[model samples]
Target: MPTVLVIDDEDMVRLVLRQFLERQSMTVVEAEDGEEGLRLLRANAVDLVICDLIMPRADGIGTIMNIRRLMPAMKIIAISGGGRSHAMELLKVAEQMGADHVLGKPFTRDQLLAVVARCLPGHPMTVRSSARSG
Candidate 1:
């Protein structure tokens, strides 16, 4: 199974994402911030990273840049629920910095699944009913 690293500061976001990704038959690993995320990346062989922007330590942009330098082939999905109006702008910068895909907050299960599928084509596409539950 493909392992996915989910880096977010919010507990609920991490729980929700973990449930969804696990339902898709992927192994889910989580970190509370970019700093922890980077540590996890160095320790584990992850297939993809779902990172939240605007985090407390080492924000997503820095994480992306470092990931690009360290693991150029790793796939990244940058996510942000911006504090102000610049969420899109930050996401754009993340893409430019090397995130393979970007997701805005409040995204649906289908959207997340679609992006995951696109990023890791060899992974199975089965969607469990639990993934659609609240």
Candidate 2:
């Protein structure tokens, strides 16, 4: 199964993402911030990184740069709902920073899955259910 690292400061965000990814039969590792995410990345063979652009300890841009430096081919999907009216700008920067894809916050599970499929085309992310309740 494809392994995904989800880095977000909010507990609810991480929980929801874990639920969404798990339902798709993907393994997920959670991190509160980018620093923790990097540490997990080093220890685990993660296939994807779904990171929040705005976080407390170490932000998404720095984390993306580091991942690019460490693993040039690592797949990254940067998410930002900065909710500060600058979320789009941050997402744009994430794209320029080498993130394979970017998603604004409050995205649906289907949208997230589509991006993941695009990023890791070789991996199979079969959903357990066709319901879009999420």
Candidate 3:
């Protein structure tokens, strides 16, 4: 199974993402911030990273840059519910910085699954029944 690292400051966001990704048959790892995410990346062989743009310690852009430098082959999906009006701008910057995909907040489970499948083509798409109702 492909392992995905989820980086976000919000507990609920991480929990929701973990549940959803796990349902798709992917291994999930959680990190509270970009710094922790980077640490986990170094410690584990992560196939992809789903990162929040606005975060404490280290932001998504910086983390994405570092990840690109460290693992250019690794796929990244940048996500953010923008605090400011420039949330889309930041996501665009993330893409420029090396995020393979970008997702805005309030995205549906289907959207998440689609992006993951696109990024990790080798992984099979496995959707549980609960995920469809949620």
Off by over 4 Å in 2: 126-134
TM-scores of the candidates in the order shown: 0.91, 0.90, 0.91
Q: Is 1 or 2 the stronger prediction by TM-score?
A: 1
lDDT of each: 0.86, 0.86, 0.86
Q: Give the TM-score of candidate 3.
A: 0.91
> lDDT at 65 for candidate 2?
90
**Which lDDT tens digits does candidate 1 get at residues 1-134?**
99999999999999999998898889999999888998999999899999988888679899889988999899999998745578888888898999988888878888788788878999987643222111
Model 2 scores a C-alpha lDDT of 0.86
Q: In model 3, what lDDT does residue 32 have?
A: 94
Per-residue accuracy of model 3 over 1-134 as CA lDDT, tens digit each: 88999999999999999998898888999999989999999999899999999998898899999999999899999998745678888888898899888888878888788788878898888633221111
The true-versus-predicted C-alpha distance at residue 100 of model 3, in Å, is: 0.6
In model 1, the runs with Cα more than 4 Å from the true position are 127-134
TM-score for model 1?
0.91
